[model samples]
Target: MMWRRRHIFDPFYELKRMEEWMNDLMGEMQTAGGLLLPESTGKEVAPISRVPSIDLIDKGDTLVLRADVPGVDKSDISVNMKDDMIEISAERKGEEEVKEEGYIRRERHYAKYYRAVPLPASVDKDAITAKFENGVLEVTMPKVAAEEVKKIEVK
Candidate 1:
């Protein structure tokens, strides 16, 4: 006679599995809605985009721009200023565990973000200074002095 071991189902294990499934679903929805939520080190939840929100301020002598770029490496960010336009770009890489787990419902947060702002006045591109700290980027650009207008009399 062949004897087969009978499998026993534990209610607690099933409930825990269900909870995990529900959490994964909610995470997907959050990511789809373009939500940027805080990340927990214990377990990476839904990977939200790392696109930095920005604020541009027009000061008397300099144009100050602040961007909220969290969870992004400093080396992945770039800023460019040309004439009266400023461009900002950044990228975030997805977690390796999420990629390895092909069946798990996770937000593939590998994302690239780009933004351009037009200055209200001309600025000195060479004199621009930018600083990044605590996931925030601040850029200061000096404004060019206005040229004096000389009226010419036409005969």
Candidate 2:
């Protein structure tokens, strides 16, 4: 038996509702010079998107950032640590393709994506390390330990 996808709707797919939503959005975008639509594709070409697939482990005086960067070139990825922010950027290869004879309809296409994460505190920027392997980018930043003891001289 084929598995049926369950949506927040009746068994019948309510396609018209989706169509109406898209129409409303596109209509609003038209005034903005159709900014959402790319000139090359003549359709809505969304910029690269990204998701946070990471873990933060507190190890006394350090932290580990494991980011999921699948299907991207490690060389193109850049990791930056400044003040209280961890910036990552990369130019992934576009997924445009050529195909033949395999469509009654063609929609739900995908485009590149980008994701950025902001750090909470000033990480020890000098010790930031990045490792990219098996399509995952891992960043390790050692925290600067705060002063545990203070000595005050009486004057």
Model number with the top TM-score: 1
Tens digits of per-residue lDDT for model 1 on 1-155?
97544486678878999999999987777868643343522223334333457888988998999987676788988999866799887777875434354475555556666566788888888899998898788999999998899999999
Please give me the total number of clashing residue pairs in predicted model 2. 5
Give lDDT: candidate 1, residue 102: 44
Q: Kindly give the stretch of ten consecutive residues in candidate 2 with the minimal lDDT sum.
A: 40-49
Model 1: which ten-residue window has the lowest total lDDT? 40-49
**What TM-score quantifies how close candidate 2 is to the native fold?**
0.52
Candidate 1 residue pairs in backbone clash: none
Model 1 ranges with Cα > 4 A deviation: 1-51, 98-108
